[model samples]
Target: MNESNGHFRPDKWRIYFIYLIAAVLFAVAGGRLFYLSVVKKDFLQNQGEIRAVRTVSIPATRGMILDRNGEPLAVSTPTWTIIANPRKLWELEQDPNAKTTPQTEMDRLAKVTGLGRSWLQEKFEVNRNKAFMYLRRQIPPQDADEIMAANVVGVSKRKEYKRFYPSGEVTSHVVGFTNIDDAGQEGLELAYQSSLQGTPGKRSYLKDLKGNEILRIGQDVSEHPGENIELSIDLRLQYLAYRELKAAVTQNRAASASAVILDVKTGEILAMVNQPSYNPNDRSNIEYDQLRNRAVIDLFEPGSTMKPFTISAALRSGQYTTESIIDTHPGYLRFGRQTIRDLGNYGKIDLETVLVKSSNVATSKITLSLPQDTVWNLDYELGIGSPVGIGFPGESTGVLPSRPKWHPAEIATLSYGYGLSVSALQLAQAYMVLANDGYKVPVTLLKQELPLDGRQVLPPRVAKSVVKMLESVVERGSGKRARIPGYRVAGKTGTVHRVGSKGYEYDQYNAIFAGIAPASDPRLAMVVIVNDPKGRKYYGGEVAAPVFSRVMEGALTTLNITPDLPEGLREVRLEPKVPYRLAQGG
Candidate 1:
């Protein structure tokens, strides 16, 4: 009977059972807490971010291209892109189930955005299934501000940059331009892309469901501005050269023309321009033909412009002097049943006259005397058949025929610039060597500090001697038309027939003039080439020399280069339309 309370014994173990139940419940919760805090943390955090936070690309500004004088050639201006999260905006307008339909909302978007309702609707329809779309890119900031003020849901604004060329087509071939994405497409813009394009940055921030920022998360990464590049271009000289080249090209009815000016002492490219230049800002209409930097990319036989190098090579051999005479009783030289002709018989001319008159015969005689290796080596040293190392993209190496042996005919043609080709820049570099007292400096489009110590390509005495002869060519020979008042110009005229599919096209020619200004102590070297003139005349002296003179005159004046000639000297004006037959471009 005392055991009658057997069921009553439950109270004795009830506290332990309660403790056991509590312990099991606690253990289950701890496991769940661990899973939530550790194993599933990343996935949950990502899901939260997907619903609330947004990441966007930050655009970095491209650098400004400046002239050495601190003039802006290419610059980046702030622009805005109108963007929309179509799905978000659609949902925002639809959640209330309001009277406004998606089309009505889009029309309102177009009206506020200044875009036609049709365009807006079409744009929205194309991407209605998607979340993001660009409404319009590169609109003015004022327009973007107007759109922002319209309180259009899901329509957002982003900042970007657009490249502008202050000089436009005038510097198109040198300063170049960028594409719609702000990447360099041509000229120096492409060459210095890495140095000019800055790194973009990012930021993370807390935002509301409406996509409004509540607070910034962590430190905002700052965007680094692109480095400013000061180029060697002198805008004044660039424009002057461009105008004259354009005029000559138009007047001559030429297919194209190119010109380059260099600071001979520094080996800096002061100006480089080409005809048919396109506006870098207008990329959509640009033709493939107008995209090349012709001065550095296009190659043509330099004709008589190549003669000076031949003379320099010969003089270096110690076997010839500027006064060394080469007999030419006949007007041409015959080698292996091939004849090399002069404009006429430049009979018994000295080496100086060989260059002064650009006598193919005399040059051939001198060239054949030097070892083929000597000639090629000299040419290579001057940068012929090689890139001028200006960092221009697609720069031509030209065509230098390599052989252990050369036929007398090959030597003859090469001496006078046929059977070889060179870019206009290469021609300028070669002339710079002659102008810089036989030192060949690495040419550059960047401002150089005293120029890399030049390689001695020719004896200084020999280079000076050739410069003197070039002075003669400008003062009295074929380059007379290139003479600028108060500046003793030294230059050679070249009119070489363009080699065609069949051979030389007799009527088509490349008229060229390569020159050094203030010949007494040369400070500038320039080259001008007019290709395939359709006008009545096409001679280097007539077409190219005058362009050189006009450009050089402006350059000398703009740079305030002291006049070497007497103050009273006046420029000799030559008629533009005259039939001036001077030394043929080789």
Candidate 2:
């Protein structure tokens, strides 16, 4: 030790060494801070985001399907989807430190979500290794909220929608149904799926360990809701038609039935219905065949209904008129080996009587006398063998065979509506031509503000003549049962033998009735088809005509259509005269 300024001092080298060590330590710490802040910033941020950040989906609302009068047919209801991180759920359940026991927790979940406990447990075990799984989809929002309040670990609720049918089975075939994910499955729903479906949005959110949202970041994409659609169907008329058709089907014990009514002026379908329908809200008990829209899909021979077109063709040819005479002697006509016959000997009948009695032989003779393409060409111009073009799914263009050479049997059968097939919709459309005074209006299921210009498929005079002749059919002919009280109804009856695997099945038949109302000023066109009715009554007049009458009656009243029949001609409900004793008691 050396004494300086009367005090003992340590070595200078020791002080210098301590200062150098401190400087070195500060340099290392500064370099590490710079590297972390500049070189590895994005990697660390991404890792943290993976743990606490999530991309959440924002559900958009689906559009509503409304009837012509603004009545709701199909709608979307707010709902939630229950999902789970299965691995995390299993871990929490197995943890001895959990707040609730596994059995009790699962039981609570089952009760709240309406799921069986055993089923949930099995699903959990099956997906134990999956990071995500659906527990229950399209559950009611209230139930989902209740589940969320239970604080089940690794459980989450997502926004979703469930489709609801307001009219239930009444509009089932028209409005159709959606899947659990709010996607349209059939009918108009499937036809307009692209417009009916909405675009989902996305956003980033920060969630807590318990799967609860802590904060929501900015939205990455905007949600686009579906467009609302208005259909041409009138709910009032639809209900009436559905009720009458169902009653007819049940009473006749038919295999199936369909009915369609149109606004003649606008070519708008006012009501369409099919029997053997299913409830859109519940599909668990539904059959595949019940989902079909028979009015637009099923095809069958149009029977005597095609006679009006043939008669119109004849009138257009200037060779025949309403006063023209047709020889149907012996009630039958022979074409080679095939024979066309009538129910009775309607011999030497006039043009009107051919339709009045629905004489097949008379129609065959008239069709044979005319040019080869007369009837077929008229039928083609009347929208036969063509689609209605309403964008309906599975719409059929009923078979209209085009042959280079016509056989005598084919010509004979074609004259009586046997060689070609037509849907109820197509038949109705053809009748629309007669009702619209020779103009062929475009058919649609969408509401129209004004009447559209129609194509002139037939001459106005010929159409009017045919329509006038058709009035005699309901006045005294085969479609007598289709008469509506106080209304001058013009219609035709058709009874077709169903074709089986071999040929025509004699025991089975398709009973059809197509008609127009208020003959003085046509406003409505309707077609009814009852397939394979059992028992003594299977004719179009007895089966399908009655349904047309009942439905047309209610529809006329509902639409406030003016009655054309005179007061004296209108049917009166007679009441028996009260006796003197009964009058005294009253």
Candidate 3:
């Protein structure tokens, strides 16, 4: 009886201990539940939501670029990108009867996406283990639809933006182009990229078991559209300038060419063109040489075209007058080890004659007589060797050596426009100073709200004198080819040898002409540059001047600018032969 009772007692104690442990566990569990519901409820809810939701980015539309006439220069068009889920593709590959071979899969993708089979194969093979992959971008809508319709488990299509240039290479230099990601990469596109790139927004929604969006759980953030840019370029003038310049390039068999037209009153760039151009739509096959915008990017010595500025400076400083005379004899002047020579020998001439003849010796003598400080100051005021103030990418500040760096020979060389470098735009701007009656307007690619209020870089009288001299150039000097039949054109011709890596290439030259039309009251300023013409005639007068005449004539006529001369007045013919005279003593 005692043994049985002891065993029963042990069992009873075990049961009691078990009950106490159960009660303690239950209390602990209740406390844990309360803590979770009160203290960590928000954290637990967030963790649960994180596992079920996915976020995505939506790209915004880029802005359109329009010309001064409201013509589209650059625009965005809808496109599609193809994405593949590798896991789905892998599942298909595992099926014995499924299209498993990379070749077959790539062929199918290429057929639907319009990409090459080998290219698609390489992309597909890049990471076979990746769950998602971009098969192609920039696919046309029709092609994208076809690919999506194939219902390949992993493949999907998303809308994207692609850039389109309606004018193609005709306005490439000014309108510029964007990259694959629809971001501006050059020209005006890049200059105002931030303003032209729109903001992207986000949307969040709840998806059901089948992945169909069912309920909106959160508010969507709206996107901000990019602002459109209106440029100062006149599309008609741009087309005219491009056609004329391209014709000149082809006719002369030149290496390249460029032209720019600007409004004299507003400094608005009406048209800008560069030949040997590339279609932004097909940049993949473009040669680097063909893509250069020579008007702003390339620099060359201005040759005789720079004579006007030097003469104007001398006139403004009271160092000379229109009637000021210098003795130039033997047609040659020796400075240091170099001897500068004129086209021919002349005894003596006045400032007007010096400019009319574009005499190297005479101009050198004049520049040398001026104080070095005056020359340097004049150059700076004229915007030489300085930024053009036009917001263009890859613009060059043409080299204008400091006065202290000048060698005696350089003074003579610079006088005739050989030792100094200036971009085509710079030359045009300098000529504009004379056209605008001494005011130096900042060059711009944007349309002005009002007529430009320019800085006075030269006295009005001095500028007038230079204009008269430039008029003489078109009338009786080397720029005679630049004259229009009904217009009083004023301009200068430049022909300079191209500097090569080894040295100056004697046969290679850049032919240039900068001018303004209806000289009685200037309206438009233009510059034309033809590089390395292999034709029989390579001179600026022969090659570039005619282009200037054609383009300027068309531009003026298109803009309805009346001729300065009366209806009955006959076109002025170039003087048969102006008496050659040297103004500086050698």
**TM-score for model 3?**
0.88
Candidate 1 lDDT, 1-586, residue by residue in tens: 2348655465657888999999999999999999988999999899998777766567888889999899999889999998887777666555786556676667678788778888777777678767788888998999899988876777888899988888889998888887788888788888889989999888777778756778776776778889999989899899898998999889989999999999989999999999989887777888899988899999999888888888888889998976788997687777767777776776788887787767877887787877777778898888877777777888899988888778788877888888889999999999999999998888888887677777888999999999998888887687878888888888898988888899988779899999998888899999999999999778888789889988999999998889888772574754443343333323
Off by over 4 Å in 3: 1-50, 92-111, 114-125, 207-216, 403-405, 567-586
- Clash pairs detected, candidate 1: 303-586, 304-586, 494-585, 495-584, 495-585, 496-585
- TM-score-wise, the better of 2 and 3 is 3
Root-mean-square deviation (CA) per prediction: 3.6, 9.2, 4.5
In the range 1-586, model 3's lDDT, one tens digit per residue, is: 2465654556777899999999999999999999999889999987866555544557788899999878999998889998886655655666788746545666677777777877766766676677577888888998888888876656787778898999998998887888988788888889899999899878777655323456776777877778889889999999999998889889999988888888878888899898888899888897778766788998888887888888887898897988888788988888666777777786799887787677888888888898765655777788889979898889999998875566767776777787778888888888888899988888889877887667888888888778888888887777888888778888987777888999889788888888988899999999898999998777777789889998998999999999886552265455443322222210
- What TM-score does candidate 1 reach? 0.91
Pick by TM-score: 1 or 2, better one: 1
| Cα-based TM-score, every candidate | 0.91, 0.87, 0.88
Task: Please provide, for model 2 over 1-586, each residue's C-alpha lDDT reduced to its tens digit, 9 standing for 90 to 100.
Answer: 5576665557766888899999999999888888878888888889888888988778888888999999999988888888887777776666788776556667878887788999988988889887688988888788788999987767788888889998999999888888887888899888889998888888998988755579987758978999889999999999999999999889999999999999999999999999889999989989999999999999999888888888898899888987899888897767666666677676788988888777777777887888888889988888889898989999999988888888877877787788799888999999988999999889999999998777898898998988998998887776778888889899998888888999988788888999999888999999999999996677787789889989998999999999998562456332332221100100
Location of the lowest summed lDDT over 10 successive residues in candidate 1: 577-586
| Candidate 2 accuracy as TM-score | 0.87
Best-to-worst order by lDDT is 2, 1, 3
Question: How accurate locally, in lDDT, is each candidate?
Answer: 0.84, 0.85, 0.81
Specify the highest-lDDT model's number: 2
Q: Supply the global lDDT for candidate 3.
A: 0.81
How many steric clashes does model 1 contain?
6
In the predicted model 2, the residue pairs found to clash are: none
